[model samples]
Target chain A: MINTEPSRTRLPAVLATAKNSDGARDEPGEEIPQTISPIRTFLMGRSSGAGVDLLFYGVMVLCAVSIFVIVLAIIFVLFQNSALSRHQFGFTFFKGQDWDPVSGLFGAWPFIVGTLLSSLIALVIAVPLALGVAIFVTELCPKFLQGPISFLTELLAAIPSVVYGLWGIFVLVPLVRDHVGPFLLKYLGWTGLFGGLNIGVGLLTAGIILAIMILPVISSLTRDVMRAVPTSQREAVLALGATRWEMIRTGVLRNARIGIVGSIILGLGRALGETMAVTMLIGNRAEVPHSLFSPAHTLASVIANEFSEATGDLYLSSLIEIGLALFAVTIVVNAIARLLIWAVTRGAPARVA
Target chain B: MAIEPAGVSLPDNTPGPVPASEPKSTGPGRNRNVLRSVIDHSVTGLSILATVVVLAPLVAILGYLLFKGFSSLNFAFFTQAPRPVGEAGGGMANAIVGSGIVLAIASAIGIPVGIGAGVYLAEYGRNGVFANFVRFTADVLNGVPSIVMGIAAYSLIVVRQHHFSAMAGGIALAIMMVPTITRTTEEMLATVPGAVREAALGLGIPKWRTTISVALRTASPGIITGCMLAFSRVAGETAPLLFTAFGNQFWSVKLGQPIAALPLQIYIYAVSPYDEWHRLAWAGALVLIVLIMASVTLVRIFAGRGVLKGNS
Candidate 1:
């Protein structure tokens, strides 16, 4: 796997130089203290070599454990800061819909609903497209076309959310308003979901942008999972005189279902957590509506829109509470996604055997 | 098994043959085959259409930004603070500089700890409880909404310090960077051969020396690329900086002071009602997109060269 990069050679030399500098700190006369070949004891007892080893281990352990520490700290800090609202509203804070800053009233219901609906909409739109892309890449695409297409798909993920926001504002919104929204409403206007005013910046718009943003994530991840399905599995199915489509369905998609689900959940996590683009387009309204065209605010968008100007202690705490809720939702979703993917891959050999 | 021979059971859609079970019913059989082929080809065509639909936005965003944003990207745009509303000319120089400084601070704090954590995971963890816990927590942390991280930093650093500061913004970005860098570093280290470690140990090298010198050396390129990706990610983040850095109007380097950043600046400009501000926002978007796209391309090159493993 090692490809020779000229730069790789310089890294060890730099490390050696650093080690020499470290060695310079130890005088020759101090060698008497180190002559015992200090490599035997673990942590409590220390020889010189053991001391260095212990130091390294200690640092590594601390760093490793720091991840847990940071997560706990996030939970703790968010909960602690949101205490004011928790005390003020009790269980009603989440259920109440009003979010007036002037009256000093805040409720998370609309924002929570908005977040969920927008994310759900995004998932609905993105999943089929993502599946199609993934299938195309792993099963159908010609050999020469695969790499370029795959790269192009991933490039979608690399573009920042803010750029998406910019595009949503300048380009996508207008197209939706002028054409797509009218087209959908004309055919489906009897359905209240598509019947509402076409302001061009609302849950549907935000969701579509989110779908666009997350398509690459789902597609690429599913492609990875499907690629992991052994070639022998496909060959076996194909040898049955099954068509390419049927072979892919039975051999690849069936095997990678769990991983694909995980990929979808991962995309869901991203959609739920996406901020700048969603915030920019979701219209910053704090009220939930029946129609998809209504302007609404997600928990993240609310926090982004108001955290700076929120003056009252309760207002700030309420914003923090929304953040906490967003944090909790995304964490749970992502943890589940991670576990599923882990189970599929780490458990793969046993399944194959 | 139904034990039907392939020629009898499997439909022969090819022109040369018809199944014996068909009993010379050529018209219906051919029609069925044609319908099936049509469905198959249509499905494939639809998928190709999906790929195109997905790719169209990227092309449009770049094209629109280039067409609209290029004119505003001038020497003055890069050298001066944003102009007052209604005025035509100002650059995000302060925001650019602020982004650099904040990212520098974030990398300074995050990279070492992330790499160290990765070392522990690869060398000593090996599916241990603590390692699993760390890894799981990192995944969760990576998925935490960036805005929530902003809240966390606001409480931890800003509230404690009684003000928004560049330090808080940097810490917020650092928190975001840690999980990415740690995970990538762990994966890269896992790619290093165990034989290398054994050889180093056989030569009487200390375990720590072997890991830091040999294993880490081999994994450095991937780890560096990961860190770069993390940097690019944080550089474009706005929500985290919204309540943390709090945006400055002028150039300032002090860590404790409120600082401007490119993403935050773009957000402000984009949201502003003025047409001039929108123009500047377009320019900022273009610059930010170019920066991120370049970093991503670099990552692809690195991964293609096998410097990175399983991280497309």
Candidate 2:
């Protein structure tokens, strides 16, 4: 019914003719001419379309299979040896508050506590600092200073975590041990977190080191998200006589809240997975500390410290379990990040619409 | 006359005559405002202070290392092995060569797979469900602890081989390199416009040819930068190499034998009680910092140039 070129009609008509003739006649004489016809060629050509679909799906299936394989390999390898799975003390592995590998007793409480506590500390420190830096660079800073300031901030990200660890051991640990730790202990001794003897290597030092390591990640992400906020929002706030800080607080932060949260969580994830720096400065004690100033271990530090020495079934399995724990945590964090990004970007269409 | 709220304007005639008398009393208020502005500026200055606190330790460490490391940096330091515990002079030549060999091997193994996978993602993916899955897996892989990669490589390669080897070290480093390289490659490829791909296809080139010839050509600088970043990251990785490579003291070019690297050497020496060893550790740390800083700086410069060109 639709208008079309005669050349386009030729193929479909041939296909139709072939279909009709094949259905109506069975004679050998009729088959020969029909086989040689354009209609037969058209029918043969369309049959190969499924081949294209097969190739596309084939590659997709392979990728899917690989993902499943990786997950399975991790799970199977961790669980295949049952001796490693027996933390038989009934939730004691998580809550036992001690790790004496020398006595063959392994509890992850200190590591769990250290990892979570440090990451939390990092998030608390970095989120505000990052937001302030982002706001300053985006809005308050002079145009000439913006380039250098932003570049320096991002350059912090390029320094490897090992360098941070090395620096912490040499410089940060000494400074904390000599001046900061003693001062804090003298003033804030009532608080258990500051009550411990100055060992120079403790949860607080690890947290501070992590905070520095994660700062650039948080700031860079925050900057990107803040930059994406449309200029009109800022103009509207300024038109109402809002100061630069006030405008950023009301307009930019309000809009970038979800993105900023995502950025913070991303930094948190980095803090959690940090290995070398924490291991170097954390004193590597396996005891769950009653105070933040007490030496402790992290999951990453534990694996880094003991994976080589981890012989026998239980030791190896426990370490793999730790890896699984890390993997699960990372996946969960990324999922949260993805959800936050989706929530923020999803508002765009509604606003446009 | 009464005016509507939307149409209201300032009474210019009434305000102008009263301004001189009012302005005289506003001086004190202006000073108060100035004080408030100073407070605000100081708060902003405090934020910069926080940034400085975060950055200062890195600077101080570098300065200390540079100052101390310079006295030891000589031709002999580059070529000689460590002296005994109390001995005077030694170098990290073997460590440097081992690191170079491992990095070269890791790059050779990782770059092709990473680039090919990235090509598959950017060109053929089409934002399909499979692409999303690949992306998520890549994220997970990136998050996998470096030590875990070390463990995996140890189990899969070193244990089977029944001995530590540089090949095992290279494989472990390669695993670490893959996720980084893949992520960077995908990002770089994504930055290459679709129009370039289409243009190549329109000119009768096959999809594979178009991807390799045009898209990859455009993304090469970015790809190289990514590779360099991956190299910098893996070069300093000690945990993975600890068990697999199992540090060597003698000069070793053999892939099957254990090897020494700058990070492992630094770690071992730093932890040891010997004063001479500690000095070597400092020297190794200095070499490492220089290498990392240099590679990262180079990549940033190259990547920035690529981005500038892309924008233009």
Candidate 3:
């Protein structure tokens, strides 16, 4: 049918062509031409091209989606575990002070206390030292000594926390237990906190270890902040007949206060979340102790010590809940720090403008 | 407050002459200067003391570690596997190899994803909500205790498979590595000049292509340094590996099986009561320290070169 239709349609074209040829006079050497089909070009153009733009946008969307997907996955897995969710929902999980896994009871109070106490101790030890290091490097130290001293201070950060744990276990703990603890007990034994029998692995040891771990962080951040203070400010203070120390205190430190606070907060965050070193030195006992010398547990150390053996639904859930608490704490700490830093540095730039 | 424009030197002690009309009183400025000197010296001394206090333990520990660990570092310690606790003539070959494999896997998985995210944040998403989200997430992840990551990895990867394996350990290490690399990569990419990006885009190149080819290339040295920092961090992590990889007894190359890492081995040996194990622990520590120091040195060199090139 299709062949017949094409032949039937060609009859009119043939007649028209014959008529045209009869009327027209052709040049002797002229060649007759065949017409190229127009429809074919449109079909080729349509067939050859693909949706390149669609593909590009598709990939970009995919790339962006993956990040959200990963975050969702974390939330899902954490929440999906019934063991973790059930225990976390209860008010007692956070409020209750006791945390004994053997009886299937869990409370985060002691761990929270330990985390706070250790971090606070670390801050007390590290802040002044870090400030000193920053000041010395930026203001006090001779030019030749500056590089080596700064390098030495930063080297502390390079050493792993676990190595610190190992050192604490072998060297620090022994020194503390044998000599330092004994001496402190003898001298300050009247204080209830220091009166306890020394086991060596307690708040003091953990704090000291944490101080060592966090010093470099504080020192490095403070040094950077101090360096950011304007040279003109330093000069102005010095020109005002202020001594070098006064210049640094009023000009450099006052200007960098927010940055310093940020550094300290960062250090505190590190102290709070530190795991292995605290796990090793904290003695991993669950009970809250009034005495600094008594062994304790932090949220991080608790998770590290027990998560492996945690088989029960409540036990596993409690651990996850502890993690959630840690997450919340860190977010809050970082947010506050960022805000504080913004406030401090924000004024300086505006004044400059 | 303005200084004289012409060539002139200001005297150190003289106050700018207050207008002569102001009443001149007793020269309390001199006494003030004396008080200032006292405060200055005290601050300087106090600051010096504080620096010394923070530094003392580091020096002491390094000195002690070298004194103790170096003595135990003989050829035998590196050539052989760890012996029985009381037995002698063993090294940390198995632990060393295991650590190497884990770190390699971690670097491979972490570097690309981290650098890509960083590029996105710095180039396309600067000041955008997504960038803010990523930044916050990265900070939180970095602050997430390594032990928690280990637990999470254990629950998700290790326990699901019902086995402890090196891959699981690698996954845990990668989790730790990601935040570090992300942070470092973002910082490094930020260090690259906006002019470079503008120049590339001005040529009509696609934004993504320009970012990958131009911006990333310029920031490569800093990125590498960041990677090294991340590597050094995970290399020494023991808690995560403890739960995910668990420790192996003999030398084994199987990724699906439990493997011994240097840090875990050190943890075990250091805590163990045996004298031989203690010696081996010290040896393992020394090796880890050397490896870390070497990587750090390499990173500093690369970063320094990048800075020098930028200056030139």
TM-score of each: 0.88, 0.81, 0.83
Chain B structural similarity (TM-score) per candidate: 0.88, 0.84, 0.86
lDDT of 3 by residue, A1-353 (tens): 98799666565554544455543523333333243233334334543223543454345444334445555555556566535545455777776777767776778889888899989889998888888888888777766677898889888987777778878988888888898888988898787658576888899899999998999988888876776665677677766655566667788899899899998898888888888888889888888867778899888888878877788888887887787677668767877766666665555533432
Going through the candidates in order, their DockQ values are: 0.42, 0.14, 0.24
Task: Give the worst 10-residue stretch by lDDT in candidate 1 chain B.
Answer: B1-10
On residues B61-96, what C-alpha lDDT tens digit does candidate 2 reach at each position? 668889767765778768987666677887889999
User: Arrange candidates by lDDT, highest first: which order?
Assistant: 1, 3, 2
Best candidate, lDDT-wise? 1
Q: Which residue segments of model 2 deviate by more than 4 Å?
A: A1-76, A79-83, A86-91, A341-353, B1-39, B300-312
lDDT of 1 by residue, B48-165 (tens): 8988888888788778889988977888888999777777788899998998888888989999989999899999997999898898888888888889988898888998999889
Give candidate 1's total backbone clashes. 1
- Which candidate wins on DockQ? 1
Once fitted onto the true fold, the runs of candidate 3 whose alpha carbons sit more than 4 angstroms away are A1-68, A82-85, A342-353, B1-36, B194-209, B303-312
Estimate, for each residue in B1-312, the C-alpha lDDT of model 3 and write its tens digit.
Answer: 122111012222324332232345448855555565577668778988887887788898788778878998898877788776667778899999999988887888777667666766766667888778877777666766777677777778886899999999997887678777777777888988899989866755556666667777788888888888889988889988978888887998789999989999888787778888887888788889889999889889988898777555
Candidate 2: which pairs clash?
none
Error of 3 at A46 (Å): 21
